[model samples]
Target: MTLTAAQTVAALATIAGSDNVVGDPAKMGAWLYEPRKRFHQSAAAVVTPPTVEAVQAVLRWANENGTGIIAQGGNTGLVGAQVPLSGNEVILSLARLDRIRSIDTAAGVMTAEAGVILENAHKAAEAEGSMFPLWLASQGSARIGGVLSSNAGGVNVLAYGNARELTMGVEAVLADGRLYRGLNALKKDNTGYDLKDLLVGAEGTLGIITAASLKIYPLPEDYETALVNIASPEAALELFQLMRQRAGARLNAFELIPWIGLDIQMRHGMLDRDPTASASPWYALIELSRMAGTAPGALQSSLEAAFDAALISDATIAESLADRTRMWAFREQMSECQSREGASIKHDVSVPIAAVPALIGQGVTAAETLVPGIRPVPFGHMGDGNIHFNFSMPVGADPKAFMAEFDEAVHAVIYDVVLKLGGSVSAEHGIGQLKVDLLRQVKDPVALDMMRAIKTALDPKGILNPGKMLRSVP
Candidate 1:
């Protein structure tokens, strides 16, 4: 705490106008509280810089004063990375810097500011007959800076790749307020150290990303979508290999959903109708992009082949836009629909794509062993092997008590299996304040040291997102 609370607010007001500074704790809730409601911490103040120059000025002041700053975007992050870990830090909101700098459809690139909402970026690309393929449930609210900062992976990673891959370059503010103007549409520049990659996924520990040049693809002519029935993850893995063999890069998304997800969504009316051929133990929401002048029914033909080989039991290919949207709605609502059932312990984890079945089977068995009658609701990007492995509490157990007793235990059980299968404990979500200790425990000793060295070299004063990603330098 280099500055007093009042001093910090007053100094920030001077740097980024009083109107841009929020000193009142009552008004800080919007910036302080996260989506998951797990982190509850107060900030010294909240400041929204309207321009990149203002952001640089604020950073300069914070660095000089030795005050901590947490760079925040839409605040829709599941992990607590954007929120304050200590009460002394100020929340630096980039919401006011939203803008689309430029778009070159021919070049397949769009330059967007940090505060530009992802959905708006999508619209910008689409207006130019292009598409940015990084899709997330929080796209409507998540900002470009935060998305790249987390290196978020969505269902489309099987086709287009994650945020890191979609990004060509980034414009960031280093710890000392130096403008790193690395934004470029270059597909190849093997000159020296790739600094753009360094800051993209550092989670604000290394630098604050202000804007980025994101990759965009030509707008597809149409899409082939379907919902297929599978007996288990093993069968789903086999089907995925077949789809890869058939469709290659055009296979946009292959999502696996268990029977429990359908039951919960239906019991709560999350969908208008079942989006499957018939009742089955599991389902895969498959989609393939149809480019201009290409034929449709690729998904149908592939499914037919799968059926002839007995890889799938039954399937229903979407015939209309309404059906396609409904099927997607079913897949996207997997996380939200769990609330209707009960408290569920969740883990965002990933393993080798080849180990998806082993990861699921062992994880479910371990969870059930820990707590009898626990309902396992594991589902996600099966193609990428990052499953949102979650478990609903026993039917009649007390919600608070269930979470209180099983949250950490369930995490341990699931992570053990994930690690054994060569998986990551934090897959899509960055190692925010929530997973600092876990990261310390599981990350390789040398890799952790390298991360700390990078953090120290960039943020010597530890003023940027202090106590996040890497807790301490030593």
Candidate 2:
């Protein structure tokens, strides 16, 4: 028989304590409330494990009882993976397990516990004379485990790669409560299977990540940032090629921003002053890392080339740290500013680098067709081809009613364009319960079969983040 919410709470309290297990719905706000506010399911209990051993004990009990369990970290995920879906699942929060276990500057590795905040990880690396490159706006709350599990990519992914690439190894507890000790700092390991790769982006469905050994890099001396005025995505893409050819690895970030983003931010007073170089149809927020012994003006020289090529009309290079901060604030605040404007439908999708223009061009046209006067806000990593393709509701439209009317219809149209251009619906964010159906529909049948088989082999009981990523049992 299935355990009641009361019984589950009692069981979890026994494993940890009454203090650690929160069954009261009112008190479970921190663990339940996600960033998007789309998922509001109540969990059976929120169990905060004080130690790795405590986490293991709770999992063992849940596994034996056939109870569902969801591993939660900082709970800052855009997707609903960190929160409970079925409401029957007990949330195994790793918040108390946060710690910077070790940092090897010479070896360029940092082993952080699952619940360590991403910002804290950065501090630890900086203290050791290195840097962890996985940066996001939610770094204040997003944890190491969740970041690795989701395989998050931020602006710097153009240079350092995403979470999966930066992660050297992981320590996770399988569904059956066996700890897989895979935290080794080996650069090259051609062992049996790529288990680390599978668990990194598995969205906590296959295993519960307890700790990770992340790749660290030498801190750049300074960064040369610019907000360049471009006519369109096509121009932005051309400018990106010029920068890649000129700056190479020093080209840390090359993001595309639309005029709509500037209009929204300025109208709402989200920024103290305009950060761009006057006004144009679009903008590209570009940054180049200046390593020790490297000269500056790499960004300036590249912009000159872009200007000569007629790809960019005007540009503003950040002369001071404050200038750089303001430029980045404009980029980072893109998602939050949309909320202030009212309801917005967002797609975190990606295509090949060359196909970004086509994706944006066709995607905007398609969304406008669905909802006349719909505002398209296509912006993000242009170099990596991941655009946070979002659409704000028509001005003064009822937010709830607009979403109710066109959410699914808009998705169908946008996703159709993404697939036709050889793009993915989910780029940075993983398929939490949000995209499971879409994944099943768009993914190759054989690839889906392989994913299901692997999930079954690793988590036979379907307890680790049940019903996430994979839709059904193999």
lDDT of each: 0.92, 0.91
Residue-level lDDT tens digits of model 2 in 1-474: 899999999888998999999999888899998989889889999998888888888888988998989888899888899898888888888888899999998899999999999999999999887999989999999999899999999988999999999999999988877889999999989988878999998888888999999999999889899999999899888888989998888989998999989998999999999998799999999998899998888888888888889999999999999999999999999998999889999999999999999998898888998899899998999999999999999999999999999999999999999999999999999899899899999999999999889988887888888888886686
The true-versus-predicted C-alpha distance at residue 402 of model 1, in Å, is 0.9
Q: Which digits, one per residue and each the tens of the lDDT, describe model 1 over residues 160-232?
A: 9999999999999988999999999999899999999899888888889999999999999999999999999
lDDT of the structure predicted as candidate 2: 0.91
TM-score of 2: 0.98
TM, every model: 0.99, 0.98
Residue pairs that clash (backbone atoms under 3 angstroms), model 1: none
